[model samples]
Target: MAQDPPAQDLMHYESMAQDALRGVVKAALKKAAAPEGLPGAHHFYITFKTEAPGVSGPDDLLSKYPDEMTIVLQHRYWDLAPGETFFSVTLHFGGQPKRLSVPYSAVTRFYDPSVQFLLQFEAPAGEAAASAAEAAAPSPPPAAPSAGEGEAKIVSLDQFRKK
Candidate 1:
C-alpha cells in the first residue's frame, strides 16, 4: 500500500475573523435598538444576500436584488428589536412603515460611517428560507433615503486574494 502524501490545508482564520467582526455589528445594532436612537450621527449600512436564510421582507425587493441588497439605519426607523440570533425593524418608505426581519447570519456586510468601521461576511451555503420568507411578506419598493446618497467603501474579498 502506498503511503498518503503530506496533506496541506489552508488556514480559515479569515472566516473566523469575519465572524468575530460580524459580532461587533450585531452588538452595535443591539445598542442602537436600545432607548437611545442612533446616538451622535451614527448610522449603519447593512448589505446582505436576499437569498440567505432568515431574511423576511418583500418579494419585489428580493427580485430587485436577485442576489444581495443594502439597507441603512438612521432616521424614521422604528421597532428595532435585536436578539442574539436576529434583528427586526420597521422603516418608513414612501410614507409607509414596512417591517423587516434579518438574521445576523444572513448579513454579508456591515458598515458604520461615524466610526469608519466595516465588516464583510461570506454567504452561507444554503439559504432558501430567506427567499421564502421574503416572498411571504408584503412587497415594498426598494427605496431607502440614506442608501441613495453616501460615501461608502465597498468591501470586496478580491482585495485579500493573492495572485
Candidate 2:
C-alpha cells in the first residue's frame, strides 16, 4: 500500500519560498542602488506586470506596455532606489526620462546577462488563477530531429561499417 499526499498545504511552503526568492531580488536591487551603480559590466533586465497593485509608471509607458514591461538598468538609468515593498527607478524612454515604482510582488523576472544569472517567479495570483485552465493544458512532446537537423547526431558511422 502507498501513502496518499496531503490535499491542502498547511505550511504554505511554496509561498514562503517565493517570498524568499523575491528577497534575493530586493537585495540585488539594493546593491545596484548604491553609488557605484552595478559593479563592473553587471546590469539587470527586470520584467513586471504593468497592472499589478502599487505599480507606478508614466502614462505613455503604461499604455505602451499595458500587459507587461521589461526595463534595462544599464548605463543610462538613474536613481535606482529599493524600498520596503517596492523599488523605484528612473529610466529613459525614447529620449525622455520616466520614473517607475513597482512593488516586488509585481516583478516576475530578474536577470543579469553579464553573469548569466536569472530568477523567474510565477505570475501574480489573479492572473494565474484566471488562466489556470489554459496553463494546465498539456502539450505533446517535441518531435525529434530527422537527420543532421541539429548539433547532436543520432546515428553512428560504425553501425554501417563492414565487419
How much RMSD separates candidate 1 from the native structure?
8.3
User: CA lDDT, every prediction?
Assistant: 0.70, 0.75
Separately for all candidates shown, the number of backbone clashes (residues 3 or more apart, or on different chains) is 0, 0
lDDT, residue 131, model 2: 41
What are the runs in model 2 whose C-alpha is more than 4 Å off?
A: 5-7, 131-163
In candidate 2, residue 57 scores what lDDT? 80
CA shift of 50, model 1, Å: 0.8
- The total of clashing pairs for model 1 equals 0
**lDDT, candidate 2, 1-163, per-residue tens:** 9999868988988888988999999999999988877899997878787888889988876876665677777677688889888999887565567899999999888877788787878777787774466459854332322322212111212222247
Candidate whose lDDT is highest: 2
* Cα-based TM-score, every candidate: 0.68, 0.78
